[model samples]
Target: MTQRFLRVAIALVCLTATTAWNDASSAVAETTLGIGDKAPALDIEHYIHEDNGFGKVEKFEDGKVYIVEFWATWCGPCIQSMPHLVELQNKYRGEGVQIVSISDEDLETVQELMEQEYPGKEETFAEVTNAYTLTVDPDGSTTEDYMRAAGRNGIPASFLVGKTGLIEWIGHPMELDEPLADVLADRWDREAYKEQMKRQEQFQIAMQKVNQLAGSGKFEDALKVVKKVLEDMEGADDPRSNLIREQLTAFQYNLRLDSGDRSEEVMTFFRDQLAEAKKDARELTQFSYNMMASMQQGTDLGPLAGETIAALKDAVGTADEEVMPIMYVLIAQMNASMSNFDEAIANQKKAVETSTGRTKERMEQMLEQFEKMAAEEADGDQDAEGDKAAEKVDAAK
Candidate 1:
C-alpha cells in the first residue's frame, strides 16, 4: 500500500492488517464477467472531461489498451487515487493506452464535486482530472455490465483491457501499476493469473472449513486441517500461493494463540516469526499486532513480552512518520495487557506526541486513560498495606 493509503486506513483502525486476502479474492470471484473475458462496451452518458486531447472512448478498439475504471464522487479513496491515475494516463497515452473513469452519480453531482476546490490545492477536481476520460453513466448500465456482472461491490476498481480487447486484470486502481506495466510491455500472463485465481479459490475453501471447525469448538480438528493445507501448499511458487501461505501462516498462529491450552505452541510460532521478521519494520509491527489481537484469557505472550516491545520500538525508529503513531500505540497496548502500566503510559505519550489531527486527539484520550489506570493501580497498592500486588490488566479486547 502507498503511504497516502496507509495514512488513510490508519484513520479507520489503529492497526490495519495488511489488505486481507479474502477481500482481494472476493474481487476475483466473478459472476458474468472476469479476467480473460472480452472487454465490455463503453456506455457513456456524459463525458465530463476529455479536454486533455484524449477524446471520449466510444468503443474498445482493437490494438489499443484501455483502463475501464469505476469510481464515485463521494469515495475518498477514489479521489485519492485520481492523481496517480492521471499520472498513469499521461505516462501511457502515447502508447494507445486510454483510461476511462466512470461514476454512476448524476451529472449535477459529478459537476458540483469536480468544480469545488480540491483539498490542499487551489485547483478544482475537474482541472486535476481533466487529463483523462471522466464521466457519469446516469443509467447504471455501464456499472451493471462491468461492476455488478463481476460481483464487485466496491468503487475505484479498475479493469485493464489488453490490446486484444480482453479484460486483462481487475483490482484496486492503486495496485494497477505492476499489472499495467506488464500488459504494456507484453510480459503479462493471462494463464498464470487464472491459476492464481484458482489457487485463491482453493485457499478460500480451506479457510471456510477451518473457520467452521474452530467455531464448533474443535480447534484440534482445525489445527489438523491447517497442518494439512500448509503441507499441501508448501512448494507452490505462484504469487497468489505465496500470499495465501502468508495469510494462512497468520491464521495458524492466531488459531494456536486462541486455543486456550496452546501458550507454548503460540510462543514458539511467534519466535520463528520474530526471527524472520526482525529486519522488516512493517512485518515486525504486524507480527506484534496480530499477536496482541489474538490474546484472550490464558493467552500468555508474557515470555516474549520484552522482545516484542523491543521489536516494536525498533520498528518505530524505522517506520514512516504516518505509521509510527499506531506502532507506539500497539506497544502501549501490549504493555498495558501485561500490566506494565508505566511503560504503557510512556509509549502512549509518544503516540500522542507524534500524532496530529484526529489520531492525536484519540491518542491524547488514551494517554489520559492510561494515567488514570496507573493512578488507580498505585492507590490499590497503597491500600494493601504497602505490599506490592501483581494485578494483571489488559487493554486489548
Candidate 2:
C-alpha cells in the first residue's frame, strides 16, 4: 500500500472502531434498506411544530409524499440547510408533500435552544425553524426505525417516502430536490437507482477487504484486490474508478521502489508518469509533492532528482496563480536537498511573496532556515581558507 493510502485507511479504521457501531464491516452490512424497500414508520416522541401550529402526527397518510430528515441543531450543515428545507416545504405543500425534521435531542434541550437568542441575528432558533414540522426523538424510536434500519451512521441524512409507503430515495437533504421532483411526477426509476446502489455496495465491500489486507502489512495481497477493483471499473466514467486507478498506481510505485532489483523499471515509470502529469498544473503539483515526500522519507532518487526538477520547472511555467506558490516551495526543497542552496533560497523567497495565510507564513519560515544554512556554509568555507593560509606561512618560516 502507498503511504498516503495506509495513513487514510488507519484513520478510517480508528474512526469506525470508536463509532457507536460494533465494527466497520457490520456497519456496512447493516445498510440493508434500499430503494423499493418499504420505509419504516414514523415513531416520534413529541411533535414540536405542525403546519404553522403545534400538534402531533402518528402515521404517514396515504397519497402523500413525505421527507423524513434527521438533523440536529448543533450540526452546522444541518442548520444551513434548514431554510432550503423550509422553501421546499412551501413549494410542495400544495402537492401533499410534508417535510418532517427530526432531532434526537431531548424535549427540554430542543425547547431551550429554540428559545435562546442566536448570534448576529434578531430571530431565535425557534422563530427561524417554525416553517417546517419539527419534532423531538426523545426515545430514539424514529431514529432506530429510520436511520439505524437504513444503516445510516451520519446525520443530515434524508429519505423520501413515496405515496405508497416505499422509500424512493436516500441521500443528503441538500440533494433532495431532483429525486423529490421525480417521485412527485411519477417518473422515478427504481431499477436504475437499485443498480447504482449495487455498484456502490460492491465498491464498499472491495475497499473493506483492501483495507483489512493493507492494515495487516500484507500489501502484496492488498495490491491484488486493488488491481481487481481497477479492472472491474475499467472504461467507466465514474469518478471512483479514477480514484481507484490512482491508488493502484501509487501502491505499485511504492512496491517497485522497495524492490532492490527494480530500480531501472521504477525510474522509467516515474519519468513516464511525470511527463503525463506535466500536462496539467494541478496534476504536476501533486506529482511533485509526492516525489518530494518520498525523498524526505529516505528514498534515493539519484539522477531522477534532476529530471523531476526540470519537469517541475516546466509545470511552474504554466501553473495557475494559486498553484504556482506551492510548486515553487517544492522546487526550493528539491534544490536544497541537492546542495544548491542559492537556487533554493531564491525559489523559497518567491514562494513567500506569492503565498498567503498560513502557507505564506510557513514559506517564510523555510526561507529563513535556508538562509541560515547558506550563511553557515559560507562561514565554514572562510574558516577553511584561513587555516590553509596559516599553514602555508608556518611552512615558509
Candidate 3:
C-alpha cells in the first residue's frame, strides 16, 4: 500500500483503542449487534485441543462465563497476549470461567505452528496453550457468528459472555480483565458502559472525517480538523492528542514544502521538528523514513537534503541498536541520490554489517548495485579521456 493509505489504516485501527463505545441503541444502529445483545451460539467445526477440565463445550452453558477470543498465529499481539489469557484462565477456572482461543487457519498450518519450537521456549504451542481450549473454524461459521455479527473488523478481538449468554463486553483481549471481573460479580454497569460507547462513536466519526480529508490531499483542510481535535479533546497531554499534533506538524511541513511558499522557512520548520523528534528514537526513525520515502516518490528535497542528512546523523547518535541499521540505509540512499557514490557505498556497507536476516541480505544486494554503478561511471570517464586524446592527435595531424 501507499504510505498515506498505510498511515490512515493504522490510525483507524488504533483509534478504536482510545475511543469508548456508543449507547446500545446507537451501537445497534451502527453495527449489527452491541453489548447487552444475545451472543451468537458457538459454531466450532472441530476442536484442536480441549483441556482445562472443560472438554468440547459446544455451546454457552448456564452458571458459566465465557471469554471467546478470535486470534491467528501470524498476529504478534495475539501471540503476546497468550500468556495473559493463560493467567486469566487459571485465575477464573474455579469461578466457572473458560477461555476459548479460536483461529480460522487451516488445521495443518495450525498444527505445524503448535508443534514448532519458538525462540526462548522449548514448549510446543499445544503444550504452551494447554490451559485453554484451542479450536479451528475451517468454515468461518464461528467468526461469522461472533466477530462479523458484532461488527468487529480486526483480529485479537474478545467477547465476554455472561451467564445469560449475553455479550457483557467487547474489546481487545488485553482489556478484558476488569469487565470479566465485573460480569463475574454481577456488578457490570450497562448504562455507564453505554455512555462510554457513545463517546467512542463520536470519536470514530471525527477520525473518519479527518482521515478522508487527509487522504484526498487536502492537507490544509485536514490541518484545520486536526487543530480542532487538539483543542477540543479532553486531555491535552493524552498520547492520542500528542500523536495528532505530530501528524499536524508533519502535514504543515509537507504543505509548505509542496507549495514552495518559503524555501528557507520550510527548512527551518522541518529542522525544528527533527530536533524535537530526535529525543524519541521511534519517532525519529519513522520521521526519517517518511522523509526518505517522500523523496523517493519524487518530492525534491533540494538544499533540504543536506539538512535531512545532518538530522539523520544526529538521530543515529541517540538511536538504539535496532534503529541504527535502518537509519544507515536511509543515509546511504540520500547520499546516492546526490551522486556521492563512495559515501553511499560506505554507509550501505555499515548498514549491511549491522543488520541481519532479510535486511542484511537486501543491503548486500544494494551494495553490489552501487558498486556496479561506480564502475560504470569510471568506465564512462575513461572513454571521455580517450576521445579527448584522439581529438588532440587529430588537431596535431
Top candidate, metric lDDT: 1
The regions of model 3 sitting more than 4 angstroms off are 1-30, 228-397
lDDT winner between 1 and 2, please give it. Answer: 1
For all candidates in order, the CA lDDT equals 0.75, 0.70, 0.69
Q: What is residue 4's positional error in candidate 1, in angstroms? A: 29
TM-score of each candidate structure, all chains considered together = 0.66, 0.54, 0.61
Clashes found in each candidate (C-alpha, N, C closer than 3 A): 0, 0, 4
- Model 2 clash count equals 0
lDDT of 3 by residue, 1-397 (tens): 2233323323322221112122111222247767888878787876777545888777789989999998876554576577788889999989999888889988887887787554235677778788888888878888887877776766688888899988888877887888899989999886667655555555555556765675576657866775676566645453334544565556667755654444777888877877777777666656666566555444677766777788778777666555676677778766765567798789878878875443466667767766776677678889999999999999999
Which candidate has the highest TM-score of all? 1
- Clashing pairs for model 3 are 21-197, 21-198, 22-197, 22-198
lDDT of 3: 0.69
Worst 10 residues of 2 by lDDT: 15-24
Lowest summed-lDDT stretch of 10 residues in model 1? 1-10
> Model 3: how large is the Cα RMSD against the reference?
8.0
- Residue 67 displacement in candidate 3 (angstroms): 1.3
Candidate 2 residue pairs in clash (backbone atoms < 3 Å): none
Better of 2 and 3 by lDDT: 2
